[model samples]
Target: MASETIPITVEFTGGLEMLFADQRKHSLSVPAKDERGQAVTVGWLVHYLCVEVMKDPRKEMFVLDGHVRPGILVLINDADWELEGEASYALQARDNILFVSTLHGG
Candidate 1:
């Protein structure tokens, strides 16, 4: 049986707002299954960039690279996952995910 299309909100940090918006409009394909053993659309995992940052313990080292970028906060709803459990948190239908950058300058 086919699954219903679930709507989800995705927010990006820093200058990624435009990129995230574009991503939502023409989302990439992803294989997801719903509650009833049916296939569903859950959009693409556009936050891989953040995941890469999390992988390294020496944050300063990774930060030096251009891929890391600024604004290092990604939240599921109002809760920042880094404080919660990072990407291990499972996404549900109609979830509002927000990503924001942390600012620090001298």
Candidate 2:
């Protein structure tokens, strides 16, 4: 049987939207589990963004060393991702994930 996909909304702001063609919000779906059969978390979503969604070559601006780069803020369903377990937060249907960049300049 095939696992159901989880639909979620992704948004970027505070300059990070530049990497996504200046489109701040995107709606997409992802598998419910990873290849290891674990629930897809924010970390997985980050990788998905780099590999699938984002068209620009500046992946390092969104991820660094396998994680969301510092100076960037992530919010889950309107709450800080830290409170939702950060990267380990399991994605849910219709969940809204937002990434805001704090860095300045080009």
Candidate 3:
């Protein structure tokens, strides 16, 4: 039978870890498909992180208007998310997704 989930590594940096239970790295097995029964994409992962992983209430710091806030860089497997089709990129097993916040409070 096909696996129901896919393994992935998510890293938070540039002070973003504070929003994720103060952890820098997380090893997770996410659903292989979303509620729509489609391949899970980076966008789905983002929502998962916010709802299932993030413990802090300051969600706006990481996401805004249902999307990653500006100044946060998303890297997929060491490459820019933009190069990988941004949020539309389909998640693969063992993929590493990194979120780096470029905005820092003074």
lDDT of each: 0.46, 0.93, 0.95
Off by over 4 Å in 3: 1-3
For residues 9-96, write the lDDT of model 2, one tens digit per residue: 9999999998999999999989998988899999999998999999999899989999899999999998999999999999999999
2 or 3: which has the higher TM-score?
A: 3
Give per-residue CA lDDT, model 3, range 16-37, as digits (tens). 9999988999999999988878
The 10-residue segment with the lowest total lDDT in model 3: 1-10
> Candidate 1 at 84: error in angstroms?
3.4
- Judged by lDDT against the true structure, how good is candidate 3? 0.95
Q: Candidate 1: where are CA atoms >4 Å away?
A: 1-5, 21-31, 34-44, 47-70, 103-106
Order of the predicted models by TM-score, top scorer first: 3, 2, 1
Show pairs that collide, candidate 1. Answer: 71-101
Model 2 spans > 4 angstroms off: 1-3
Q: What are the TM-scores, per candidate, against the unseen true structure?
A: 0.47, 0.93, 0.95
List of clashing residue pairs for candidate 3:
none
